[model samples]
Target: MGGLLSILKGGAKEEEPIDIPLNFGAQPSGPEIEYYNAVAGLMRAAPGILNDLRSYSGCGEAIRQAISNPGKATEDAAWAVVCPAVAKLKDYYDFSCALGNAMGAHAGADQQAPVVSPTEQLFPRILSFLGNGDASQNFEQSQALARKLAEILDFATQFDNLKARSASQPAGQPATMSNPNVQNDFSYYRRTVSRMKMNNAQSVAVVSDEVANKMSLFFAHSNPVTKALIDSANVAVMSRTLSLGGATDVFSILAGVSYHMVAKGRAGNDSAFFLRVMVVSVLLYDHIDPAGAFIKNSKINIKASIKVIQSSGGSGADALLNALRFSTQHLNDETTPKAIKQMLAQ
Candidate 1:
């Protein structure tokens, strides 16, 4: 009976079992994931790709050099080197455009972050202003400057907040006011503002009469330190203008103003009042253009402007101004006038 049962079990099991194969092919990725992956791959591949292109360029340059020298190399040999380089260059061009288009499409779809250029990354505030349209582009240019001013205000707010928090804390508890990082940041802020004040003073010296008047008006109700800086700048401008036979070249004035602001920021004395003046002056200068204001029939909003300056009290403001400076420096003179026009329109 045991043997019969074992035979029956074996026979039942012997019935052919069906084997189903499972396919685990690649799954489709989401748009965002695909974009991120593409970006990551590009980032990783960029250095190698650039290096390869450089090598090709070098090879082409070497061939060109050889061809230029007398009896250095035959034309056919040069052509061999040149032709391949040219072909590779064409491939690179195609690849670059394709990648750019892909990235742009992804960004347009809001599926991925916009790919920032090296220059834009270094000067992020300028990114806001980069546009094809006149009005939109012009509006973007001031964004950095405005943001910087706002940041300065934020710093002041932060300090005030810290003070308030400390005051509210238990009497036996330690205060954040004593934190080294906080103190250092505040010190940095002071130094940065002092520098800005020096720059504003310098710019004030070289600006056009109309601009100077506007600046004076802008600072009329500002802190005493700002007023003092403006006075000094005006004196310098008067001397310089007189020496130059009262030449009011807008470009020269702008250049001087920009230079002085940067220099002052680098070398000015650090103080809260000085910092406030610096921030206010720089922002006023950036926004206050006689030509633009005249074209737009606009007047400076003193109360609003004052509020902007007061509120700008953080490290982010400094970063924004730095970016604005970079953008301004890089922009062409022709474009600058247009940008100014746009600012005035606002």
Candidate 2:
């Protein structure tokens, strides 16, 4: 952990010694202290959590290989890889979720300015959303949904263009690309894709459109507390899309899937749980922009560091060690709170 802290600090000069008065009468006690302790605990546990994830990535790769080349691998072989991988993933997710939950509970228990129940509710919901098996499934579903939405968007654009041409044409003059056959084909495809469901005489767009609308709202809204959770979900969707051709690395795929589930809001009640976890986790650990760019950048750096460590033939233990080193090195490069850093040092 010390090594990791050093790495995150980025090789800065050591501070000069200074004489100061000591308050030895009594140690501080209050919600502030509880919050400090919680964040310190998270910092200490982060490397271990990362180590487990690195191991889980290996399992993810084995499962991927087995699935891709089924002719050479049996179903039993695939399950052998998948079952253990899923179990490890679950363990990591549960630990992180629990940490977030404990933090929120402590915060709410404070007598002064107690945290609202809804805010406290977010942690478990975010965890449940990201920790479950459905996350991967949701990523898969999102791909299909995205493609269909793209088609609908294209159709809408084309229809608007056609209408514009018709209106702009001179009287008694033929419009450009105004062939009846082409128009009919376009209408057919559009109607087929946009087919509606009728229940109680109320019409609902296809599932793809509904998902697209949700995604739009997620991106459009600006809620600082839920920003990390939302960004993680977006990353998950992009990562899954990239993995289709096996171009993306295994570690990225894992991170992306975890984020995607929470961001996509596909886990029903689980979504709320995971969002809360993310909000509380950041507020506890990161003092600089708890829900902003700092958290996003930290995630990016962690992923890059993991990739570097794995590429150099590092084992899970080595990865953890190196991650600690890297985190310590860069700690000084960012605006993470000084108090939080000092707490970690202790």
Candidate 3:
């Protein structure tokens, strides 16, 4: 507490006010606006978000270092909290990476406006907006993130529910993860064991480069998320529900994942149910998305999915359909389809 006080002595630099632009054809209203307001600052100034994340992530390492050098944190905890050595802490210099990219795709003065990334480079780059980073992580498509999610979130015991969902999947059908846009997101999932020929690898042929260019419209567990969890779940279901606390779970992932970008904003992730509320968003959206893989096999309605997760009285269903109210900039972007954005807003 004493250490946090010193940083308050310095005056923060002034910058132009930034706008939070989440395009939903028409302006987003009600919960959508509230959700947008919640994350707009982070998207607009994602670097600041990164710093907060870095500060949070630094706590574990800082304690280890602080133990080795007593009074270092008390002498200069501000720098210590940000994870720089007290000696180097004074050298801290910041670049506002998201300031340029916020609003529209503002180009660097040296760069040409016409040559912006073929795909939009979202502000505060952590989102990679159009890319599948956030989505895949939420839906358990990212193998690494899911393993961690299992270790931390309160849903480990629900693995059977997940397996049952997967087991229920009929062979040769359109999976929730079949969307071509998010298909490349699973590049890491394409692997072949020693004896599994293309036949065993889910096909007689799967061209890596052209995997997305063209392919059969139907597949079984080729969806890496299902394939990864199916075998892992069959081996064991966690007896205990492991969780890093809802706030920690959500904040840690956002902080860890937002690397090249940083943004600042928001006040209310404090709903006693904030983590559940936010997580619920991820689940619901994933369910709604054509490529949503969490409940890839279910034909349930999105609202029903939301209701199941939101109303514990009714049962949180599988509890995988909700999103963080990840209220992410995705809803803010023009790329998001109107109907989906409207649905997400509610």
Error of 1 at 268 (Å): 29
Q: On residues 95-138, what C-alpha lDDT tens digit does candidate 2 reach at each position? A: 43333322222222233322434333333333233223433332
lDDT of 3 by residue, 1-346 (tens): 2221221111122111111221112343432343334344323433343343233222334343434675635424422233232112111111111211211222233544342241122121212221222332332233233222322221211221232233334322223433221222122123221223544543332243232222211122223222222212211112112121222223223222221011221313322222233343243223223333122121212233233344431233223332223322234445444544455453
In model 3, which runs have C-alpha deviations exceeding 4 angstroms? 1-290, 293-301, 313-346
Query: Best-fitting candidate, measured by lDDT?
Result: 2
Ranking by lDDT: 2, 1, 3
Clashes of each: 17, 32, 29
Misplaced by over 4 Å in model 2 are 1-45, 54-57, 71-73, 99-346
Please, what are the lDDT tens digits per residue for candidate 1 over residues 156-191?
A: 222222222222343222222332222222233233
Q: For each candidate, what is the lDDT?
A: 0.29, 0.30, 0.27
Name the TM-score of candidate 3.
Answer: 0.20
Please estimate how well model 1 matches the true structure, expressed as its whole-model Cα lDDT.
0.29
Query: What's the CA error at residue 121 for candidate 3, in Å?
Result: 28
lDDT of 3 at 337: 41
Name the weakest run of 10 consecutive residues (lDDT summed) in model 2: 15-24
